[model samples]
Target: MAHKRFAQIPMSKRMRELCKEEDFAFLKSQPDQDQSSEESKLQESQTQKKLERDHRQEERQLNEQERQREIEEQKKVQCHAEKEEKWKSHVAELAVKREAIHAKLHRLREFRDFQKKVLLQDLDPGSTNETINHLLMRL
Candidate 1:
């Protein structure tokens, strides 16, 4: 069996060849020995920092919005509970008022019965004192 050998190109050589073929003049251009344009470096770092800061700000805003919603929901629940309590108290007050009205009606009925009895009884002026005494005793 015969073994076939393949030629392998170095990675840096291949990159250089590709750069030449593509006419990528930017990569081959040299900067002052310090490396990279100061303006471009400053813009890149500032842009990255700005993006991170903006992301954090957005997250904080979202969290605040969520907390506000929760607070609103709790307020709604509390308001509903207060309304329910007010309704129950109103109902109880109405019941008490109704009972008082019933008691007054019963007292009026008793007074009417007493007046009817007095009208039905016929007494002479001489016996008025005796009738008064009898009525007082019944009471």
Candidate 2:
């Protein structure tokens, strides 16, 4: 009977003490846990902001590179156009020179034919100089 009462008193008192210790532990951890949670949230926001800034910077660099490429392409096209224009002008000049040469060749052929006719008239055995002159005038 005495052993049973001793057991009951110790068990109840131990349970009460354990409950008090748990309560104290909970109270002690609350402020520290809250502070850690706040710090974690702040760190997350900072990381998000950094990511956004990096994204914007990357986008700007891409745009700049594209613009530079466009400018270079335009310059190349313009240079090609200028070269084409120069080629066309050179071809036109060559054509003019070719026409002048063709005209000169025609005139030279006419002059050669005239000289051949004069030589043939002088070589004819029966035709006198006066007759040759008359024939030449008729021609």
Candidate 3:
């Protein structure tokens, strides 16, 4: 029954009851040591929580920066596509203008040939058809 009662007490308190006076003085300070150890553990837990919060904030900032970079890249790609389309349109317009200029130059050449034929006919009213054809061929 006495053993059962001793077992009911905590191990440290049991040691305190059995210890000499000098050893009891040392055991009496055990609670203060336990309190200081608990305080250190609490400070360590708070520091760990603060570090975790800082790490989470850094991750969020990095994610936002990556998102911004992707957006800027998309904008650059869109702008480049727009510029390429405009360049192709301008090239097509220039081709059309070139063809129109070529057609005008061909018409001008035909008109000049017709004027030369008329001038030759006026200059030689008695010329034979064969002679006029031969002169035109030489021209």
Candidate 1, residues 1-139: lDDT per residue as tens digits?
1112312534476665665656546644534465668866886799999999999999999999999999999999999999999999999999999999999999988986786467447655456655665665686
Which runs in model 1 stand beyond 4 Å of their true positions?
1-47, 123-139
Listed per model in order, the count of residue pairs whose N, CA or C atoms clash below 3 Å is 0, 0, 0
- Candidates by lDDT, descending order: 3, 2, 1
- Spell out the clash pairs found in candidate 2: none
Residue-level lDDT tens digits of model 2 in 1-139: 1244345554576676776688789877565654777787887899999999999999999999999999999999999999999999999999999999999999988976686577676676766667655665675
The full ranking of all candidates by TM-score, starting with the best, is 3, 1, 2
Best TM-score among the predictions, by candidate number = 3
- Which candidate, 1 or 3, has the higher TM-score? 3
- RMSD to native, candidate 1: 11.0
